[model samples]
Target: MSDRYELFLTCPKGLEGLLAEEATGLGLEETREHTSAIRGFAELETAYRLCLWSRLANRVLLVLKRFPMSNADDLYQGVLEVDWAEHLEPTGSLAVEFSGNGSGIDNTHFGALKVKDAIVDKLRTATGDRPSIDKMNPDLRIHLRLDRGEAILSLDLSGHSLHQRGYRLQQGAAPLKENLAAAILIRAGWPRIAAAGGALADPMCGVGTFLVEAAMIAADIAPNLKRERWGFSAWLGHVPALWKKLHAEALARAEAGLAKPPLWIRGYEADPRLIQPGRNNIERAGLSNWIKVYQGEVATFEPRPDQNQTGLVVCNPPYGERLGDEASLLYLYQNLGERLRQACMNWEAAVFTGAPDLGKRMGIRSHKQYAFWNGALPCKLLLIKVQPEQFVTGERRTPEQREREREQAALGQSEPEVDNKKVESNQAPAQIEQARLSEGGQMFANRLQKNLKLLGKWARREGVNCYRVYDADMPEYALAIDLYHDWVHVQEYAPPRSIDPEKAQARLFDALAAIPQALNVDKAKVIIKRRERQSGTKQYERQATQGRFTEVSEGGVKLLVNLTDYLDTGLFLDHRPLRLRIQREAAGKRFLNLYCYTATATVHAAKGGARSTTSVDLSKTYLDWARRNLSLNGFSDKNRLEQGDVMTWLAADREEYDLIFIDPPTFSNSKRMEGVFDVQRDHVELLDLAMARLAAGGVLYFSNNFRKFQLDEGLAARYVVEEISATTLDPDFARNSKIHRAWRLTAR
Candidate 1:
């Protein structure tokens, strides 16, 4: 055999540079980096040492031969010329793994079969016996990578991937592979910290992968020392003496490292079931004396090492996949930041996560960030120094107080000291993060105050308590602030992709800070929501289960609004003018409300002395809500709320109505409906059905919120159609004229 061998080390994506550095440190020569892999040259002893000590490599491949090939025949001939007897016994089992597709062999399985056939035929001719295939524990494992019409055949020296360190038998839902965990540790500077006798802790440790890898690093233990089986264990070229010497050296180093004082390494998991499994893994790695795992939550996690010793706090929190999950995980990240600030002073923190947006919500600034790939998903590792200066904290001072501080500074007087006791107590981190506002935030606050002063007079004069005060007044702060009695409902428009997420988030925080102070409302009464395009029933889904309703008045009618339950607060404030028009014109006439969400307009028609009222909707939940509204107004006798598909209901109803109001959703795909509802496509049929039920000389009021809606040209020819969209706009909705479109249709 040769004294020097060409070696290739494979790893997870995005770790090629780090692995190259590690391989060079481990005595590899002429290192070259590729995508997810590294190529180098090493002596037989160094190859054995790499197999024993490499923590970032997934596999260590020993290149045997490189040849040019263009077809399957060339592939077969290359393997046949390798002289199989020198590498494997005739009766020994082997497995072939092929990667890359080129030179007309596009299928990996077919390429592997072709290689196996060539090897078997060559060994049979040479030794009169063919080798059988044993895929699981093969005596020899050959890897063939075809790239750019070149075939590179190699032997896998490290079996079953170097990541399988033979310690972890049980893992959690989403466990990081051992090699990736080691990469994260190295990037977090764990090696230098461990050498300095520092400590390590993972607050959200799942199955203790970080703990085990860290302890092994601090104790100078070879990761694969306890492994029994390897791809080169039964190879014909195996050097027993060289491997033995290297293994002995590693054993001596471990023994000597263990004799020194143990470092402080610990992990805390919230799941009780994982505690035993984590401990078992640590014990199997033979680091039980150095590492310990306990069942604990992140909120109360306190790492008490030596008093003055500082270390690293590393964790991988869950990245939620659903929209609703982000709401709850937001608090989890905030709590983690709070605990770090309170307990881990002066320590370095490394938070690895797939959701960088949630990571920003932690209220701590990270000095450095590194990008990594966990399988196919992109992730980030945020490095922070847990110092007092890194904490985002300040008291929320008013404009007067800020001006006073500036004046005091000008007069050679010291600014008043903020009470640190409140911040250090059990107060929420978000509450303590009320720092000085930016110039844009101050301008936003001024606009809000100006809007309140102007709209307040209009609202009280019109007997309106729930009106929109501000709607995207400035482009930078994209939000709609509506007042419902003393509460403020703020809906932030989702920013476009061109906007930076961190800047948008900061602007949102500034807007939220300015809201309560500008409107003179309690912070608890401010309901914030993110507005984006909705499909199916997402717009109707309840955001909270507060189950509390508030009574409000408009045009001599009582209504109930549930601000916390849904995206829309029961009442459609933009349609106030249309509802009032229906009430005024419904005297002594039968009224029909189609697609009645909560029957708010139907209640107005009933209160306007309509002989009888009927409302149709698909949601039983909203039907129940409509029933409560009628009961709250004491007009349940002549009012009828039917829960069914509007299109299906309109087909079956033969009763004529003197007045009709139809407001349909832009799109709906509820399971209870036979087919999806698209207002743009089905409006003509809907309007035709409702017109057939309308009494002669009566009016049909049609409206929708679809901005792209085009009225059917055939309908105007069939009836006298006049667009009343401009007349439906109240002063509160004048800013957004396209909020809804209305039309008054009369039979000719």
Candidate 2:
């Protein structure tokens, strides 16, 4: 009979029961449970089978010996008793992973050195040779764990932690360990649902850790079957024939599992770049046929099979601490709950988050909450059974919804888009004048429709998707409304309180209510911003955490516009004409963009066949957005997005560009800049600095939005300056000609 050896199985903390059950199922005998660890005694063959079939086991350790020691010398003496020649050859390479501190042995490195000295001395005396120490990628790995006054030395049968399945090639910011992901699935009751022939969906899937883990569970596939090597594979005591036999059994079971009917599983991720990585992982797992990953957002995610069918929706959305402030992410949790409560009747929902308070923001009453650990953070898994009766929303009911729709129509508020239909302003002129609306509301709606009519033709002809539709056109409704493709952005110019506050608010509400209907847009697609003179960077401060974006074209270049998360969308719609001018003159020229928010103008230059383009901005957030814009346009590495103070960069730059665009802020005392910048006070210095970098026969387009700005007469005469501010304004912005000023300067 083969001698039995004590085996220790270790896994992530909080998963002790699941690992213990797995060991028992694999025929392990005398299994004893501990927190985050399990101990059992079994024969070598049983151990081999456990290595091949146990999915939750992180490492299968064979306990070599246990001894009580008082200090380093006693540790060395006790370790020397083990036969050194029995395990590794004198010339073989070995590494020791020591953990914890013993009595009088406080440092792990010193303890490892002492153990090595003892083994080398015993082997050298007998064979005149000693094993070489290899700290990294060693042939044999030894482990020693020290308690109060005792130590247990063991062989780590699993070379590396089993969390690495050798399948995940791409990892996003914060990824869950594979074993921990599997444990979450088990804790969420996915196995029971899958056994009953239900499907699964993950809306906020990041690189698909949860989806891949869920697929493995639903398909009944072993997790580590793809692993090629284990520590025991090279050990002197390994039984090769027995391991190979169990490996073949695992393969047979996997093959049988693959033959079962397809499991209905789907994963949705908002970022398009991450979908490919998820596909690669699924393919590597041999479960591509069962899982489908889509590039989408949870806000618009409508899982398939809307009627009668029931399934589970599980996702690991970000907690407030890791990504940003907790308040910023509260809307995300609330939106997730609203999605589930509104659509997922009879379906079960599980939300796993590190911040328990964020879980409360989910809005649904969780029937059960399971405490788990994601790495070291205390997390909660909220389980909710979605039902129609559980929704506590502010949406109007059926009759009230219709009444509201009719009232909105009477007030000229936009309705949901009809199938292949739009509510254009050119529909009828006389009918709008005849509609019943509040006097101020009717006039506000009429002005909006008129501007859309005037700009629509020019916008279509110029291939512009974003333009200023109304720039403070009506005094009563002093607001600038811009149309970015299908979404509307409304910026209200704060009026003086001398104007009746109630009257101004009423007029503002009338305009807001009219925008969606008059422009054929959804109310949710409108982003409202209050424009006021700022003494600081509050103009660029973030407003919301939705981070929602849409694609809009300007001057034949596609750009991404974020409607939420900031006071200003990435693109400046009034600069549409200026961007087009740059594209017209950018061929074969080098381009520079200073104060380049999102670099939309730089993208136009690059698309216009500029030899090279450099975009400078002070914000890393905007720089990252600029990089994404360049990548979206398929620009090569020749384009660079630089983050720095524009003045400093201009002073340090020795390279010359054929064309440059400088659109500085009116006033910015940015902490990143060495000094404050005011366009009126520093225009000449900024202009001269830019002209110094202009190549021969080059012209610099200097522009700013400062309303009351005057040219520096001396500097203007120094260079041949041509004021082309008239041509820079399209018909839409003609009403507000003083909105911006542009000048073309060239060396005489």
Best by TM-score: 1
lDDT of 1 by residue, 29-148 (tens): 999999899999999888888899999999999999999999999999999999889999889999999999989999999999999999999888543778999999999999999989
RMSD per candidate (Å) reads 7.3, 12.0
What is the TM-score of each predicted model, taking all chains together?
Answer: 0.72, 0.58
Model-by-model lDDT, in order? Answer: 0.87, 0.78
Q: What would you estimate as the lDDT of candidate 2?
A: 0.78
| Model 2 bad stretches (over 4 Å) | 28-35, 125-128, 300-308, 320-328, 393-748
TM value for model 2: 0.58
Q: For model 2, how does the per-residue alpha-carbon lDDT over 1-748 read when each residue is reduced to its tens digit?
A: 2389999998888788888888998878899887778999998888877776666778888888889999888889888888767777777777887878958998999988888887777677454667888776566778887878998888888888878888898977788888888887887899998888888889988888888888887777778888887887667787788888878887888788778997788998888888898899888888889889998877777766646557899998876442123223544665587577545766898888886655654545788888888878988888888753333322224655556545654444433122223325444422221232346756778888888897898888877778889877778788888888788877878888799866775576557646766787755567777777876567787877777778877766778888767778999877878898899899999999999989988999998889999999999989998988888889857898888988888899899999999998888888788888888998888888889999999979988888889988998677999988999988878998888999999998
- What value does the lDDT take at residue 362 in candidate 1? 73
What C-alpha root-mean-square deviation, in Å, does candidate 1 show against the real structure?
7.3
